[model samples]
Target chain A: MMNSPICSMLDIEFPLLAFSHCRDVVAAVSKAGGMGVFGAVNLSPERLREELDWIDAHADGKPYGVDLIVPNKFAGKGEKLDTGRLIDSIPQEHKDFASGILAEHDIATDELDRTRGISGNFARNLRAEGAASSLEVAFEYPIKLIANALGVPPQVMLDLGKQHGVPVAALVGAKEHAVAQVNAGVDILVVAGGEAGGHCGDVSTMVLIPEVARALKEVGADTPILAAGGITTGEQMAAAIAMGAAGAWCGSVWLTTAEAETNPVVKEKMLAASSRDTVRSRSRTGKPSRQLRSPWTDAWEGEDAPEPLPMPLQSMVSEPALRQIDKLSQSGHQGAKDLATYWVGQGVGLMNQPLSSGQVVQQFKEEFAEAFERLSASLGD
Target chain B: MMNSPICSMLDIEFPLLAFSHCRDVVAAVSKAGGMGVFGAVNLSPERLREELDWIDAHADGKPYGVDLIVPNKFAGKGEKLDTGRLIDSIPQEHKDFASGILAEHDIATDELDRTRGISGNFARNLRAEGAASSLEVAFEYPIKLIANALGVPPQVMLDLGKQHGVPVAALVGAKEHAVAQVNAGVDILVVAGGEAGGHCGDVSTMVLIPEVARALKEVGADTPILAAGGITTGEQMAAAIAMGAAGAWCGSVWLTTAEAETNPVVKEKMLAASSRDTVRSRSRTGKPSRQLRSPWTDAWEGEDAPEPLPMPLQSMVSEPALRQIDKLSQSGHQGAKDLATYWVGQGVGLMNQPLSSGQVVQQFKEEFAEAFERLSASLGD
Candidate 1:
């Protein structure tokens, strides 16, 4: 029941948009009155089609969206490496280091090839050309929004969004990037802070929100802004609105929800972790992404650690090892459990409880009302 | 104009608190219906007394506070190095690196010892013992508040505050530290985030304020929180309050004001800088302190740069060369002008105009009301 422009632009009752890889969470949040955005970066084109099909039917015709990773730049983007040579491109040193991490955890690193479920899709989604297949699937659905998590969305995506009457949102961590995205014809900007889980610049949301808003006004752009990063509560949503964000775009808050696709082991770690228990490192994604502090992450930050390779190359080394660790951890491997970690924001401290996706939406409405009332009270003298 | 608890506690008309090293800024802000805190960390006891005397006489009986830097941990805390030994303790390698940066910028590396005004006072104030002398001077004045910048205030500061019926405040960058400060008898918590000007943790103000608020509630402490870091306007102030901060405590906003002690060269750079320009590096004080981007800060973060020495030793190497650079930059030296920088926050992007201390406070009130109106308008829909 917020009056931010985003609510009407997206045809959602509330301005909160939950981001998750789980189709169930997306459908539930959309049905619960808030928009649900499915993270499709890890899904194959076929898988994405099926997920959107499921969400379309299960979302009860409520608004839902899809998020694709189509970074403007990545390693081997120009070279156009096929899957075979791309896998071969990873240095043996990095391979050993990633494998060595799991080896130390007493997990067998010999069977790293079992992670095709994510690697194939991740490699395919590493660039806009590959992501076009997924976009084709997303556009076919009756979606209200589509977002790009890294860099400015390509001209093709913007054009398609215009054709379909769906808004194209790009996430930015700095004001200049926000300006650039707006100039690139992005309909909405998710101004994320450094405390965000995924790739982010050094500016904080508190500063970025106002800076982007003022910069947008200066440049004569009316693009709406959805605040992201470290926002897990409705009170923070109100704060975002006060700072000129039209609404909140939350990602990590759903990671530990009952219907989330998060690895059970990592979900438990996230629930127990505090704000101080995360570090922004490039080891996982070849960009500074915030992840829970664990033996695996700490080793990469150590003095003897090699500089992480660029994205896709770094992902080739990390995802397989992490996937193995995630599997072994669930099957009674204590060392793997100790070394396991996943992307999470500093707001993990505020997300200790597990709730249904719809329940989380309900909780947000109640808390948002409480926070608004509190601010209204402050207006009195 | 607002009913935040900090307003009543500080006996100010607005909940805004201006932090500045200039007594003029402090006096002006307090006289303009807000609390003005005098940053006394860089002042000698005699100088502190003189400045306080000036403020007391000129403040027109308005409320004001004093801040001291008594870090919980620093290099050479218990060693009790005398002036001669402390000066000698700085490694020549660091001295050469610092001198090399200035020399490359065409500033003279010679005469590094001429900075007794701040070096001697700073050397003395490196520990709680030296800070106690300044505290004694501060207690003699009718200050309404006393704050510690680095860590929990020592027991004596707490005891003295209770003895004098003055509120003792402490700055915390994390939620645990906030809880510990409140439990240590501090009446107020300055929850500074990584986006703050000086020493700060990696958590953003958007996350830290709510994290600290929930932490204090969990610990059953009712200590009031003043949000700091990346906050420069009344709209951002309202956002901080909406996130559960009692009020906004701003430092960077005053650095470029007419009455601020900022060097003209550095102030110009800050005015031109965006939120992306600052870097949090240990090169300044052997702690992650945010400062304006300049050639000087860039050199330290480059490859092959030596690891910054611990606290006071690093300060010794940095302060002399920076003081020289600051002097030459104002005297029409191009290279020195390019090298000049100062502590600031990401909020520096929002601080483009040069207003008086009183005008900044007045503008904050107006912007805050407009933001409240915007939020209330949202509630109507």
Candidate 2:
């Protein structure tokens, strides 16, 4: 196997780190030689423990990781607001707006699980204390790495990673953020660009990788960087490595994998969508998050629409409605189908067909080899 | 000298294409072993001839190219609208808004040159017929390439390119646009990302290059691509090539070069700015063009501000105010200094100091070599 510092550090065959929410996809990717990082943002500590247990049994002793979202700021952040209070804090106007949109689509809002079974736990889990519970559970498994999205991982998260002998990674959108992460003692830097799915900043991946890499090198920090955002193929991975990244950290590509638990309707949209189908809107999380553009997104962008509320509040407004939409869309409601959307990058245009998680990894290996060969071939003797 | 297909095609020592509006910067870049493409959108046919004549005299036998903005859609694109007619079409409200901005800053709006020297010629030169006149002058010189921004080159431009043995290139923001350009018989594709300066699309360079490359290859089109947008260094140039591009077509990097004609105040801002300092706003060109953020941009984005008039009309309103601002800012006026801005990319953050055009080229070569070596080192035997 080709060796990189990240591969050696993580003890993985290839340096490709797959970010997915599906346990099956995570295990399949790890078994196929790449490190599968299960996104644990939406899971309770008990559910997370159960999910990690399943991956531990299915991953065949391969190294894997977990990713958690411990943002630097969110609604009721550092204030300790309970779920009922947080929910109450949401303005009736926003709730009415969300419900109004669903009603327009003929989807019953009551059928949607507003509390998602964790009634007041959503705000708690996103806070430092809740992340600790999830982290504690994650460390119980034989995980090799842990990553935080949205901002620098808290010092506690970093300290736990050190105590558990696992490396901690932080995702940054710009060079200064990378510098801050290094100052915070992050073990790995996942430099994601604006083209990335989920939350992203305006800087593109092509410029951000080299920008972060050069900034780190200049500051005498040797932190390994994994380039993320809008990257869907082996050639892109090879391009990232060539540009000074340790590897390519991918998320959106896995959404179409056979083992992914993505909404079937959304997956079909992703398969049929072009690069232009995605838009970076704050409608989902209150911060700018790239997702497939639908009537739902369009309505939010309309002139009369109110600006999306900040994180946690926006999630509260969107998730219940979207969950209802996903369920109805799956059941073949025409309006729900038209209004369906999910987090995806512009690379969705290229993701035309569905492949198994293992197949995707295998193709990445081959494509990366081919791209490397092409680059070497360009360097004439 | 590094050899690539684009280098061979353009007959340059390296595959780096420097896009600059300054003739001196263009000539210096060409003399430094890369192709310098002079942006001729703002020049009249007679002035363009003079610029090309100077480049031809001073380029020292190195190949250079010319770039023109013959956009597919613009104000009075098909109909022949004379300059007075075009300027007369500007709404009183837009003119008042622009003048009001200058008034608020204590700058005398009446002293500004409303005609900007070219008079009605500005609208004329952007049309097909006007572009043809400039093309006639460009072909008179020993030009090796010609490119069109905003859309595919018209059939006449393509035919003229073929007849003159100059490869015609078009800048595309999406894969579908690349296919359209290839189908339009364009010889080279300049895939620009949203991070690019001036006009850009939503797709980022990291995703756009590989996306266009793969899309073209899938359709059996072997057109060479010149990766562009927010690219400011040799390492970025190396990254573009590794992602299957034949070369890097950079624009904003030259704005800070010692030989550039960029406004002195704006140049200083570019030197001190970070990647996040630029914002894509239609307030400048009526189409979203990335420029340095200032009080001018902020005012346009303000709630009570009117929407920027489309293309030519917006230019009419802004050009008068900005030209006045640029002149006063250069003369040490405090209010003008705060309001001055210019077209630049996100890469402005990396452009810390002013260097000679030749030094910038030399730095790129060395940085590219270092990056290439780094990639090879990562590929273990």
Candidate 3:
């Protein structure tokens, strides 16, 4: 069979799209013939500019993409609220809880202040500004695509892509959401189901792919669908294509690549994780995302665990705790290290070893070929 | 939340039934208030009689159950093939392939004859004989329930249960499956989803529970639905109840219990396993079952690996490999140990420690109570 239109059109050998904030992985995956999507969520404008510039120079002329988090659901949207007002709107109890957790870990109070405002409108505004600046950096290079995660891309992102003659992709979970993205002029739809890493919805890819593909066709929308969630090997990709997806979009498999910017301690945990090690919780981004269930997630569960605040509010409550935990984890603090968690997909279970991005891509091709041969053999009399 | 009717009617305090072949765990879970359903699939009639006798002597008058694998879909109700004829029907190449793998692992070939006639008629006969003997032993005691695992219980099992005035339960995966069981006159339906360990169907607990509940309501079938899959903690039990399930049917959680028959080495792996460690593959049972993905599973997945035969054919291929691997794993042969795999649920990730069955039940109660309180606190706010 011919490669899926989405994969072929994106000029990648595999439909896999590796999402990471690490520049090294972006460069590596692009070099390996799978698209690397730079996560622009946590980057500052200047930092993103530098990172994109680095990727542009180091990506070996292979195509790559950029991922921006633009939530369709957000607090204070269209209110024109200032950062101070939004910060003030956050409950003090939540802040105190985060502070007390960090204090218990013996993180200095001054460093805590530096971490205090790590959330709120400051981060949102930074993400927004960073997206815009990163768009400039991306346009300066030969970027293949730009994807908006968590929501529909703003009109400016679409316009920027149009102006650059590049495809603007949108990540969506539900079929209705896919239709909305298609209506919003999204060039490609990254259909992520509940089994995907990070923020996801409540549908498995087995059901979600065909549902979205049929929905797109019925609406006469030509938007190509890239299936995401719990997909790892070539056989899974073949199954997704057979189910009507234009291609498969992957993330978790790349998290353990040689170039990944994963926490050493957390990476060790991930190396041993099976497909069942994940839980979908809103503790991270205020949206339900699958991550390795560590003590940190367990704390937000069970009795006595605080009720996770809504999306952005939840971020304010947990981000500081995460920051401190990561710091102590880096320094070999055992208890804090046990609590450090990272976003991963259920497919992490299939990623049994750490290989270079190029080796991973090669393995997929080999596995895919064998799987197809087996399928054909089974079909024969 | 009130306990489900299946539990209440059966006089069992909890709906979570720990299904296993181990006598100690069966006895422990029964004493812990949760019903234990002993899997009689592999047990010989005499062995099953002995185990049931032990349970009868040890069980503290708590309600318990027995599980038998009686496939609704199987070869020859009318075809009427003998065990020897069915064994002859299996391809010689498959047997040769299995032999090569076993020999390569240094497993004794002397037991090959004993292993060859496993799964299909072999399985059917074993379960039927064992179930009959188990039923005899069970009837001698105060057995509260009897369950058919793979499909709706045979009419004989239902008849026996009816004669004994005990409820007959059937395990199902989908809403339609639940309806079928209910229509077949099943008194209890264990609605297991894809996230569950062992042999299961394609559905998640979140969507499956409500769907099955709605289906049963629409069909006017009052058969109680016990939600199974990915349920470990009491909070999950509460959530399952909220989703209309009478109670949670759990198994993987009990595998790590102190009295479990799981290999100590494998138990260590299970303890360290995050939710991501499981995969649904038919390599073991010739029918899909959620299992911990180990080097054993990886061997089956490789290009050089023999394609697993279907149903009874594949069981003959797997039983010997599993037995040999388990033996070698105990001896600390790293390669053989690596190949050791076990059927477990996605909830294995929640089992971080080896607790007694009673401790697990107690913890579930505590967490469930807290979750209810939290939900109540959020109400009328």
Error of 3 at A138 (Å): 2.6
- Stretches of model 2 off by over 4 angstroms after superposition: A110-119, B82-88, B117-119
Q: What lDDT does candidate 2 reach at residue A18?
A: 92
TM-score of candidate 1 chain A against the true chain A: 0.96
Residues B269-379, candidate 1: write the lDDT tens digits. 888899889999999878789999898999999977788977666777788788888999999899999999899999998999989989999899888877778777776
Candidate 1 chain A minimal-lDDT segment of 10 residues: A114-123
Q: How does each model score on TM-score?
A: 0.97, 0.96, 0.54
Q: How far in Å is the alpha carbon of B203 misplaced in model 1? A: 0.7
Candidate 2 lDDT, B120-206, residue by residue in tens? 555666678888888888999889999998688988889989998999999988889899999989999999989999888888887
Candidate 3 regions with alpha-carbon error over 4 angstroms: A78-88, A96-111, A114-133, B1-381
- Candidate 2 local Cα displacement, residue B201, angstroms: 0.4
Provide a comma-separated list of chain B TM-scores, one per candidate.
Answer: 0.96, 0.96, 0.90
Q: Looking at model 1 chain B, which ten-residue stretch has the lowest summed lDDT?
A: B114-123
Candidate 1 residue lDDT tens string, A194-248: 8888777788888989899999999999999999989988888888888788889
**Model 2 lDDT per residue over A1-381, tens place:** 566889888998888999998999899999999999999888889899999999999999999999998877666788876667667777888888888888898877777655542335556667788989988899999999999986889888999999988999999998999999999999999999888999999888877888788789899999999999998888788778877899989999999999998999999999999888999999888989999999999988888677788767778788888877888899899989989999999888778889998999899888777776766666666
